[model samples]
Target: MSYVTKEGLGKLRKELEQLEQIERPKITQQIAEARDKGDLSENAEYDAAKEAQGMLEMRIAKLKDIISNSKVIDQSQLDTSKVAILCSVKIKNKANGQELKYTLVPDTETDLKANKISVHTPIAKGLLGKEVGETAQITLPNGNQIDFEILEISLE
Candidate 1:
């Protein structure tokens, strides 16, 4: 099962609608135009159009699967007592003494530029269920270890 916010679910729904209503028709028209130009065996345009259509259909199907299996969590009912999805956490690095803040979010809603990290990530997984003032040892992809102390957790 996939967990997502209401906003993320809405975004997926909008993308699916666009793929079905707008992009599908556009690709069909392109295919028709290409087919009218020449024979099927020698037509490069027709082959490219068909390939693009296949990729688009695959993307649409994946989006539909994600949406169908998703469970939207209510942000208002989220508790700030521990680290979880949609919870903003403040942590202090034990080795470097640097502080960092990140909002734990679903995979589909994760954006590094926005300081949103996926809950399935290593650091996020290590921080989950840890309360304030507790230290968590996280293993990085580079085989390095980092110790962090949870300073705060807020849903706002």
Candidate 2:
């Protein structure tokens, strides 16, 4: 089972609704239009439309499964004692002296543009359970290592 924040769960529900309400109807219309072209034996548009619809349906089913198994984590119940999921961690790169803040989140909720990294990432894994003032050495995907010093940890 995956754990997600309330906001993340809301986004997932909204996406599922859009797929069912808007995309499903749109794809159905496409299929009907392709069918009107006649000659099902040689119709390229009909074949393509059917393929697209199948792919969309698969996506919808996968999203539904994820939503059904997901659990929303309450931020208020979280402890601030150590680094963990849902914690906004502030860290300073030891070698470059650059400071970066990342909010560790579940895989489905990861948004790189928003500074939210997946909990499975190398950096997050290395920093897990680390406290403020502790240094964590992360083995990157490329096999390079970098150390980061934890500066702070907060719920938000």
Candidate 3:
């Protein structure tokens, strides 16, 4: 099971709708058109369409599974005293004196461009259960360690 915010669940539903309603039909049409061209043995378009259809079907299945198994988290009930999933944490890097804010979320809701990191990530894992002003030592995948001072934790 995966935890997601309401907004994340909505986005997942929208994507699933697009795939099922629009992309599925489009791929079916492509397959049908390819089949009308020539014999299946020598038709490259038919083979390519078949491959694309298989990929699309797999994606649709995965999305359905994810949506069915996902649970939306209540933002209002989230605790602001510690670093946890769905919490926006502001941290100051001890090494470079750089301050960064990241919202820790589930893997499905992770958006690096939006500064949302997965709870399973090294930084988030190290900061979990930590309160404000606590220093968390995070070890990266490359074996390098960095300490961050938690400045604030909020629901937003």
Candidate 4:
């Protein structure tokens, strides 16, 4: 099951709608138009259209499954005492005293550019359930370990 915020769920729904309503018909028309050119053995346009349609259908199916299994989390009732999904955490590196902030979100809502890290990532996994003033040691994918001290936690 996937856990997502209301905003994330809305975004998913919008994307699904676009694929089903707009894209589906567009592809169907392309397939029909390609088929009109007749020879089944040597039609490149028909083959390309069919391939694109298959990919789009697969993507639509995956989105539908995600939307059906997802649950929206209520941000207002979240506990800010410890780090958890949807919590914005501020941490300082133990070695260099460098500070960085990240928001722990579900896999579907992760946006690296926006400082949102997926809960399944190494850093987020290590920080989970940690409170302010606590230190967490996280192992990177490259076999390096780093210690970070939790400076603050908030709902933003």
Candidate 5:
């Protein structure tokens, strides 16, 4: 049920491939190397390696499930009338006049460093479905309320 852009989906697929093809073999090699040390009952190296492998396998399975359930969103067909997933929005703080840009994305694709915010976040929630020139009252995690003016919305 994750709404992701085509580019986002491709990134997910690439990460999955890297984990399966490269990471899996690397972990397997580590296991084999640990096994060469013998002493199964009290071998700390072997135990750690096994634990690491289990964690890696779990991550791989989770990634596979996410990929299987994912749906890629077509940017060209998207409605740009208001803010929504995959839309890059520019907002200005009503109080301080500070402006910021953010791309609304699925939870999995959120990267603060990249200015991509999860749709579920307070700011994104306030911006969602808001058209240009509309003001969004956002409820921060700290329970503070702030108004943001929607300046622009584009596919970017």
Candidate 6:
């Protein structure tokens, strides 16, 4: 049950198309060019090109698998009454008295720079299904306990 945004899914599809239609051809051309240089036994360029192709193919396969398993979630259908994927949550750290905001997102769409955290993360997992004004205690990777209060939840 991997969740993904419509935009994220579209991006993956576009990248897969480019890898198949553009990068694959470019790598094939490189291999052909390297092969024409002769001496396949000692052709570093050919080896490098082949390696690149393998990596590209692996990425394409992974992207295809993700796309096949992905479930696109509608933003409008998100429930604002509690924390959930695609929900923007405002929380206050009880230990430090600091307020932080984060958007719960799928692993593929999680970006720290965008303040989107993966749903599988400890903080996000603790926050999920918690309503406003409720306290959530989560264990950090360092084995420390952190308590946070849910301040708000919004689909916007």
Ranking by TM-score, best first? 4, 3, 6, 2, 1, 5
Pairs in steric clash, model 6: none
Candidate 6 weakest lDDT stretch, 10 residues: 1-10
The runs of at least 3 residues in candidate 5 whose Cα sits more than 4 Å from the true structure, single-residue gaps closed, are none
What tens digits encode model 5's per-residue C-alpha lDDT throughout 1-156? 677777777888899899899998988998898889887888888898899889989998988888889888788888989998899999999999999999999988999999999999999999999999999999999999999999999988
lDDT of 6 by residue, 19-120 (tens): 999999999999999999999999999999999999999999999999999999999888899899999999999988999999999999889998999999
RMSD for each model, in Å, please? 1.0, 1.0, 0.8, 0.8, 1.1, 0.9
Q: Arrange candidates, best lDDT first.
A: 4, 6, 1, 2, 3, 5
- Quality of model 3 by C-alpha lDDT: 0.93
- In model 2, which runs have C-alpha deviations exceeding 4 angstroms? none
Candidate 5 weakest ten by summed lDDT: 1-10
| Candidate-wise lDDT, in order | 0.94, 0.94, 0.93, 0.96, 0.91, 0.95
Candidate number that wins on lDDT, 4 or 6: 4
Candidate 5 lDDT: 0.91
> 4 or 6: which has the higher TM-score?
4
TM-score of each: 0.96, 0.96, 0.97, 0.97, 0.95, 0.96
- Flag regions of model 1 displaced more than 4 Å: none
Top lDDT prediction, candidate number? 4
Candidate 1, residues 52-129: lDDT per residue as tens digits?
A: 999999999999999999999999888788888899999999999999999999999999998999998999998999
Candidate 2: worst 10 consecutive residues by lDDT?
73-82
- When 1 and 2 are scored with lDDT, the better candidate is 1
